[model samples]
Target: MSLVLHLDTPAWRAHLAATCADVPGLVPVAKGNGYGFGLDRLAAEADLLELDTLAVGTTPEVAEVRNGGWSGDIVVLTPWSRHDPLAVDYLADEQVITTVSRLDDLKLVAERAPRARVIVELLTSMRRHGMGPGDLPGVRSLLSSPQDSGLRFEGWTIHLPMKAANALAEARELSSAAASTIEAPVWLSHLTLDDYRTLTRELNVATRLRMGTALWLGAPNTRRTTARVLDMHPVKRGERVGYWQHRVSQDGWVVVVSGGTAHGVALTAPSPGANLRQRAVTLATGAMDAAGRALSPYTIDGRKRGFIEPPHMQSSLVFLPGAATVAIGDDVPVELRLTTARVDEIREVDAEA
Candidate 1:
């Protein structure tokens, strides 16, 4: 028994084809657990779709994508730096396009691997990585030198914040600034289809949109995640159980499901809480956590269950109240964040099945 993700092959492939048809110059991103579908699987899908380029998150991922059977131009989204020990290896490969965000890194690429293909990243409101517009002049001078650094200028890239209200305006302004210094294609992320069209029409340079989540998990109904029930034990009120020996509040069954911390269960990223309701929910969840009681993602009889204690490495102790009935070997539906989740198996089913 294990945590499994079931994918509808025909429906999922149809969605991919539809997304490709809608977005021109689409660069499929297969980074960070490949959005819950391992890199090798996504790499094979990219090949099947006949895409010419794939984008990864780091330098080491270059070989992963290559070995995964993706034999096309692979672009590393993370900017290159002297500190990156693995950067030098991929720099000499023509198919590997390294991202250069800082002036010094650009110089380093020019000095170390002059023949390397490079994408100069411009800083957006995200402020995470990339060179600012003020650094454009230095970048222009380096690339336009008489000595000719021998680097292939791939394009300019801008990664906008997901929740930015003026993402399109920011993209337009930054892209225009970068274009004035050097002419090349503009690669971007987090722009809507209409916004992409508007930017393409306004700018003279070509544009490519790098997409991961929207392209893969956009159709939520096409995929299903389930955890198998491994064991169950009845417990009376006030009885202590689990590693911490926490006392139970009511009579219930301690349902041991096949998922835990190792599988990304109970582990969560910090929530920013954009609204009052969200903040309230976060606060409530925090209170529950403080009380040593928290809700589990696993659901039974259309109701969310509660965890008896912190999840173990390979299984979780869920408190199923007396009203509900569950049996060992039964599969329980799980609401999971795919990007963080590591499932034991991924089963693909045809539409007819």
Candidate 2:
């Protein structure tokens, strides 16, 4: 019994190929649960795509890609700091490119790993990690005399906000600002293909688009997630069940499913509520959660079921009241957040299958 992610191999590969053709200098991001396909699988797919570079979220993830047989250059998207214990080990690797967002960290890299390949990150609207515009001159001066410090300046990176009303405009402003100070390739994220093309046309220096969700999960029809039905028990009205011993309101079946909190079955990230509709939905969901009538991700008999209580570590008890029938070992379709999901196995099927 497990939570399985099934991939339509040919269709997914075709999508990946098409994306690579459309986006120039595409660096596929394979990090943080690997978009539910696992890190090793994405790295191997990157090798099969024959891409020159792969972007990961952290420095420690560099080894996962290398172990997955990705021999090309690996760029860690997270800014490297001297406080990171594994920084030195990853810095010394020639194939590894570290992102430095702070001036002090850039100097640290020069002092520790002088010959390290480095990318200076510029602060954009995201403001997550990057050096501010005010610090660009210092970076430019430091890179101007690279011979004094053996650090190899690869390029500048800017991570734009996904929800910005006009991402391309923000990217253009930031890209232009960096190019004016120091001439180097610009690596970016969260831009449409047209926007990227527009930016490329507008800028003189080279540009690369780093994509994670758009690259891996672009084809929604090519992937499916499901959980196996482990067991089922009939319950009468007012009968208490589950670890919390919550009383049932009516006669139903207590169906045990194979995914729970361990697999991110019911775990949800906080919604940003950018607009009125989103805020309304969030409020509705919160109201339901407070009432203990939250919906589970599992769908059986073409309807979503509800949890008897909060999910357990490896299994969940779903309440299927009236009419709906499910047997043991049946595959129940699941709607999961791919980035947060951790499935037990991934099965690939050909398109014809």
Candidate 3:
């Protein structure tokens, strides 16, 4: 019994091919849990797509991509620091491009390996990483002469914030600012399909879209997540169970499913949106939390059930109403945020003509 992710290979291949056709210069991002498909799988997929570049989050991820036989240029999305000497050494590979957000990092890279491959990240609204616009002048100067810095300048990268109001305008503004500093293409993320198309057409500079979610999880029907029903117990009202000894208010079935926090099941991440509607949803969720009746991602008999308690490390306890029917060996479908899910097994079915 395990948490499993089944991929409709034909559907995914078709979808990925269509996405590649739609977005030119698309660099598939392979990082962090490999967007639930695992990094090696995605890297292999990217290679099959014959893409020229693949972006990853860290040096370890870079190694994973390469080990998966992706010989194309590997761009490290995260910024570099002197603390990571091994990562710096990895960047020495001509095919690996390290992102440098701070000028100090650029200086450090220059000192360590002047001929190191580099991509300068311009600070965006996210403010999580990247160099400010003012700092680009220093970046341009340091890398302006090969004799001075010896760094192989790649391009500028800007990661936009999610659900931006005027995303196109913001992109235009950032592109203009960055274009003025470096005469290189822009590597971007978090743009909608329409935004991606528009930016490619309207912007004078070349743009490369670094995408993961939309490319991989864009087709939900093609991918299925399921958990096996390991055991089941019938309970009457006020029966105590689970580690917290959470009591049932009514007669129901406690279905012990093969998924839990360790599998990234039932684990919640902060909502990326903060709009009024989202805030109201947050309040409603809070009320559910207060009532200890949180809706679970697991579905039984084509209907989602509620968690009896927070999921255990390797399994979960789900409460199904008295009338619900399920067998111990049955596989229950689950809806998961792929970015956060950790599937124990992945089963890929060949596409059908």
Q: So what's the TM-score on candidate 2?
A: 0.98
Better-scoring candidate (lDDT), 1 or 3: 1
Which runs in model 3 stand beyond 4 Å of their true positions?
Answer: 202-204, 350-353
Worst 10 residues of 1 by lDDT: 142-151
How do the candidates rank by TM-score, highest first? 2, 1, 3
Model 2 residue runs over 4 Å out of place are none
Candidate 3 residues 93-208, lDDT tens each?
Answer: 88988899899888988988888988888888888898887897898899878799988888888899976788778887888888887778888899887988888887677889
Model 2's lDDT to the true fold? 0.91
RMSD of 3: 1.8
Error (Å) of candidate 3 at residue 128 is 1.9
**How does candidate 1 score on lDDT?**
0.90
lDDT of 2 by residue, 1-353 (tens): 68999889999999999999999999999999999888999999999999999999987788898899899999998889777877667899989999999998888889988899999998887778899978988888788788988899889998998889899989999899989987889999999899999999999999999999999999999999999999999999999999989899899899999988888888889999999999999999899889888889899888998888999989999999975488999999999999998999888888786
lDDT of every model, 2 decimals: 0.90, 0.91, 0.87
**TM-score against truth, every candidate:** 0.97, 0.98, 0.94
